[model samples]
Target: MKERHTSLLMFGLIASIALFFMLNLVLGSVEIPVRAVIRVLLGEEENTIWRNIILKSRLPQSLTAIMAGAGLAVSGLMMQTVFRNPLAGPSVLGISSGASLGVAFVILLSGSIGGVALSQLGFIGEVTLTLSAIAGSLLIMILIAYVSQKVRGNVSLLIMGVMIGYIATAIIGVLKFFSAEEDIRAYVIWGLGSFARVSGGQTTVFVVIMLVVLPFSFLLTKTLNLLLLGDSYARNLGLNIKRARLLVISCAGILVAIVTAYCGPIVFLGLAVPHICRGLFHTSNHAVLLPASLCAGASLALLCNLIARMPGFEGALPVNSVTALVGAPVVMWVLFNKRKSER
Candidate 1:
């Protein structure tokens, strides 16, 4: 019965994801008929404009949102499980800040030297931004991993992550201060976060990276489940606590880095989705929660993308705003009720 219920829930979530994904294709800046979207996807659409919009824009954006949301949410679940803290996340740990700092250098420094708009640099711009994010995030991730090895206390490690994020932000602020207005505006737009920013080619690369990394994360399911039993117990069970911690953190950090590089610092999906999955399935098992978080994350992101691009808005709203807006209330409601039940 329990397994049956879980299967039903998973099916429901997948159905919702599919529905939202289709809606995203159909209801963009210019609403196309659902049938037209189907025809375009099937290579039968006669209108090049509709075909282009569906193929080149909405499709890529939806795919980006799917991967970004799933990756971040799963990373968040791993962090919360490893750190044993409900609040620890990619942004909270300064990893996203590091990526942002890296992008800031590319945008601010490049603009300070060359007058060309970073956004207008096309494919070259995407590579530059991605490389910058990878460098910045990996630097912070290495620091955090080193600190994890040294710091005996999880709280201390958590605090160190927050401090690193602040340091990254401080550096970015300095870069922005001396940068040109146009560069600053570009950086600001990037910071606001948009799934639509990624081109079809970029989206393919992003999806490929995510596909490789996500499977590795799932293979760590045993390690994650073991860690929940406390360090001593897990160690007694022959788990190398330090190695496991470092491995999980590195994987999670890489996931965050990639998503932040491509999608911007997507805030709450990572932090909130784990909690939502846990509540829905009523399971602490990584085996279940990991996949559940992935599905829930993808569904929420597609929904957010849809709302951001809804008719009246004409996709004017930033994706970060919608995710944060929707995520914050959902988390608050769950936490509040959880505390109430605990009392």
Candidate 2:
């Protein structure tokens, strides 16, 4: 009976993802008819304006939301599991901070040092930000990997990660203080986060990269489940705790890095989705929770994206705002329910 229920819930999540995805393409600032959207997707629409709007804008944005949501949620789950803390988010290891610091240097420093604002450089600016974010995140990830091997305790490693984040934030703050007003404004906009930030061929590459990396997470499900049994027991069962910790951290760090590189530092989805999945499925098993988080994350992100672009507001709201507003309540509800059940 429980298995059947879980299956139904999974089905519901997938259905919601599809519904929201279609709604995203159909309902935007300029209303496109459902039929027209379908026709455009099917390559039967002849109206170039509607076609371009759907293909060039909505399609890529929706895809980006999916990939970003799934990647972040999975990364969060891994972080929580490895650290044994429900509050352990994808950003807990400072990978996102590293990415942000990189962008800070590019957007903040270019104005002060180069005498030319990189933010005004258009495509060149965007490319530079993406690359810098990747480089910064990977660099931190490498450092974390090294520290993981040196430090035997997860707590020690976690503390080091937090200190690294603080150091990065301090550097970014110093840069922002010295940066020009326009550069600071540009940096703030990027910090707000946006699915629309990625478009055209970039969207395809982002989705493809996520598709490649996400499946590798599933491969760690068993390792994750064993880790849940605690280090001593897991070791008794022949699990290499050190190696497993490194792999999980590496996997989660890479996921966070990639998503942050492309989408900016999207919050809440990573921290909330795993809890949402656990509440829905009522299980700690990674095999179940992992996929559940993936689908739930995609659906939630699509819903947030849809709301952000809903017809009321001109342009679109920042994705980070919508996510925090939507995700915070859900997380609170899950926690409330869990506490009530315990009582």
Candidate 3:
């Protein structure tokens, strides 16, 4: 009976998510009727404008949102599980900050030298930025894990991670101060995250990166489950603790770096989405939890993307702003309730 109930709940959530996604495609900056959206989707295009809008704009945006949502949520789940802290995330580990810092340096240095936009640098800048960001993330990730070994308390690790983020931000601010005005302006604009900025080609890049990393994360399910049983227990169970930790952190860094490269720093989806999944599903089994988080994250992001297109705004809200706006309340409620339960 419980199994039947779980399956029904999962099916319901998936169905609702699909419905919202279809609605998202139909309602955007220029409203295309639902019928036209179906036609375009089914390749029976009756209107060129609707076809163009669906294919050129909404489709790519939706795809990017899906991949980003899944990637970040998985990263967050892994980090929280590895750290054994509900609040620990990609942001808390300073991984996103490291990526942001690398992008900032690229904008500053490249602009001064060649007066070229990083996007204009094409594959070269993408490669450079990705490498730098991954390097930065790995460095911070290692530092945090090391500190975590020594720190003992989960709360102390969280505080250390926050301090690391602040240090990275301070360095970025100094870099910005030294940067030329044009470079500073470009970096600032990039900091305001956007899903629209990811081109179809960029989406392919992100998809490839994610595809390479996500399976490895999925494979770590057994190890993750073991680790949750505690380090001593995992060792007794013959899991290579160091190797498992390294693999998990590396996979997470790759996911974080790719999203940061294409979409800029998306804030709360990584932090909040997995918690939502856990609450809804009432399980921590990664096999179930992982896919559930993916669907929930994608649905949440698609909803945010839709709201970003709502009328009465001169420009769409940044994707980060929309996610934060929605995710903040949800996270606050969780934290508040958790505190109350403990008391």
Question: Each candidate's TM vs. the true structure?
Answer: 0.96, 0.97, 0.87
Compose the digit string of candidate 2's lDDT tens values, residues 215-240: 99999999999999999999999999
Tell me each candidate's RMSD, in Å, in order: 1.6, 1.2, 3.2
What's the distance in Å from true for residue 243, model 3? 1.3
lDDT at 231, model 1: 89
lDDT of 3 by residue, 33-101 (tens): 888888899999878888988887788788788778888889899888877888777787787788778
- Model 1, residue 104: distance off in Å is 0.8
List runs of model 3 lying over 4 Å from the truth. 115-164, 332-343
Comparing 1 with 3 on lDDT, the higher-scoring candidate is 1
Q: Which ten residues in a row have the lowest lDDT in candidate 2?
A: 308-317
Q: How many clashing pairs per prediction, in order? A: 0, 0, 0
Global lDDT of model 2: 0.93
Residue 200 C-alpha lDDT in model 2:
92
Q: Identify the superior model by TM-score, candidate 1 or candidate 3.
A: 1
Best-to-worst order by TM-score is: 2, 1, 3
User: Positional deviation of 211 in candidate 2, in angstroms?
Assistant: 0.6
